[model samples]
Target: MSLNFDPQWLSRYPAQEPVGGAVSSCVFCGIACGDVEAHVLAETADTLCFLDHLPATYGHVLVVPKQHFQDLLDIPEESFQHVMATAKQVANALRDSCGASGINLVHATGQAAHQTVFHFHVHVVPRYDGDSIVVFPRLADPTRKHEVAQRLRTALNAPQPPKTEAESSQA
Candidate 1:
């Protein structure tokens, strides 16, 4: 190996998938089951958080439920709360320790929506000004949002999806 350093050297290295040669069939399941190696930051009865192997930004973290759930549609109330609370804790640390200007608490549900991993996980991405990365997220226009709202409202009434922590606790 040459002693000379190149800032672009890291880019030349191919990204490793889910920490490489995971023991379980499902990568995240391997992590959750402690069959895969990771720099685990936090672990709770229902959740586990660790640094991303291929981070989108500095201090990027992936928070996941220890119990397997492919997507948001089936996550139970308590498990969901554990993931959300853990994400909040990681986000605050990024702001306080890493000087993040903002944060994106991102979750993708399906493959078409860009959910690459089938296991449910939340990305607590830290952002800084002048940073090239963008989640490219936007909100619906308030005027037109009612159309979207009505569609969700109808779906909300019908059920295959379960309730969230707040929803279940309130009932």
Candidate 2:
């Protein structure tokens, strides 16, 4: 399916401009632009899916937007939705083709969260029985659970600030 994106969306993000044929600093952008070689699985109007070079599992794949977006916050809502829809299709293919018992959709946003690549992408990992990958190892503390929930709820209930002129123009 084709993506419905604002024509001026790329103009709003100056850093997304390509150098030569690709965004020089971001490898994912190069792949998307066909400047870099990758074992591509699928491609859509707004997204690309390919095998991970350093896969955690045999059929591990990455689903990314064709345009350059550094992180989750930088991606436009329409582009992000297309990426997710593509990821879901990839997950199903992995399970059917790779004989995976389960699937894990992993997305890391920042350095502290173990995001090595700056580009906005989702890792579609196929999980088999007895796999050694430990996605989440931290234990939750029950004592502060109520306080944490309240804090998150308060933030969710807060009204968003009005967009500036620059932001409105981009939209």
Candidate 3:
């Protein structure tokens, strides 16, 4: 079976720098550092919330850590918590201001998850009735629920590995 694929497809997206290291080429890092212009919404010492230029909805907002982190796994626990708090605040504001009935807090981690930006960010998408935006369209396989749960439980209960030098330094 020949699959039509382009190995260089990732090159079309922005270059990703190392975790915890800020690079000029990273647009999110630039925005967080005040080097790039973005529609500012809320700013805290550890996080920044801004309007997405290409919004999924009318009041789409992005909450990100000021310090560069490639994705969820790379971000420190404290920083990730702060980002989540800021995202909660943004979500509330979006719901209240936009009169949205519901909100979707999305955080895509890698290329397979459609995360275009390398920075760790949570997209606060305000939703209304019949918006036609389908984030998760997959039907659940009820038979595999217990099997999946057990796998997840096992992984969650497993002992955590020691952090590397770079990871320790970041913390």
Candidate 4:
């Protein structure tokens, strides 16, 4: 596919820690340590599902392997199966809980594709006719991309507070 580029937005990103480096440099590794408002749907030795912060809609969620893997090819076949199965379960829950018509599953790999966090996550964004969520358009302006990454970084770095009974189900 032909790609379009925008330079202005790309200029705003802060220099981030490298992906798949020493354990301390891993961003996803830190996610569980804080109370960053993740609505964790399920967790297992192999995988976890949690609500997406930048939801395409209310029920947008993400599924990932518990073990950090930077890209799709890096995931072992069994772990991939477990992650996908959990994603499917979450999508069904979204339909029941949020009245979603359908879901969109997505993943990005490497810096060029904007997989900023460097963790293999499958996004299960719910779809409705009037909802803002849609598939990729492939025109990356630096402004919005930078803004999104900044927002996510802020959320990821936020403090961990204690959880309530209602909030405990997802965790």
lDDT of 1 by residue, 98-131 (tens): 9999999989877555566667899999999988
lDDT by residue (12-72, candidate 2, tens digit) is: 4334322333457788988998889999999999999999887788899999999888788
Candidate 3 lDDT, 1-171, residue by residue in tens: 445343343456664544446566778889988889999997999999899887878899999998888898888899999999998898788777889889999997877766778888998999999998877655567899999999999999999999999879967
In model 2, how large is the Cα lDDT of residue 73? 76
- Checking candidate 4 for backbone clashes, the offending pairs are 9-142, 9-143, 10-142, 35-160
Best by lDDT: 3
Runs of candidate 3 with Cα error greater than 4 angstroms are 1-22, 162-171
lDDT of 2 at 140: 60
TM per candidate: 0.71, 0.82, 0.81, 0.66
TM-score of 4: 0.66
Instruction: Give the best candidate by TM-score.
Output: 2
Task: Compare candidates 3 and 4 on TM-score and give the better one.
Answer: 3
Candidate number that wins on TM-score, 2 or 4: 2
* Candidate 4 off by > 4 Å: 1-17, 33-37, 138-171
What C-alpha root-mean-square deviation, in Å, does candidate 2 show against the real structure?
11.2
lDDT of 4 by residue, 27-108 (tens): 5555654434466778877787887765657777888887777678677677789989988888898899889888898887
Order of the predicted models by lDDT, top scorer first: 3, 2, 1, 4
Compared with the true structure, all predictions reach lDDT values of: 0.79, 0.83, 0.83, 0.73
Q: Give the Cα error of residue 72 in candidate 4, in Å.
A: 0.9
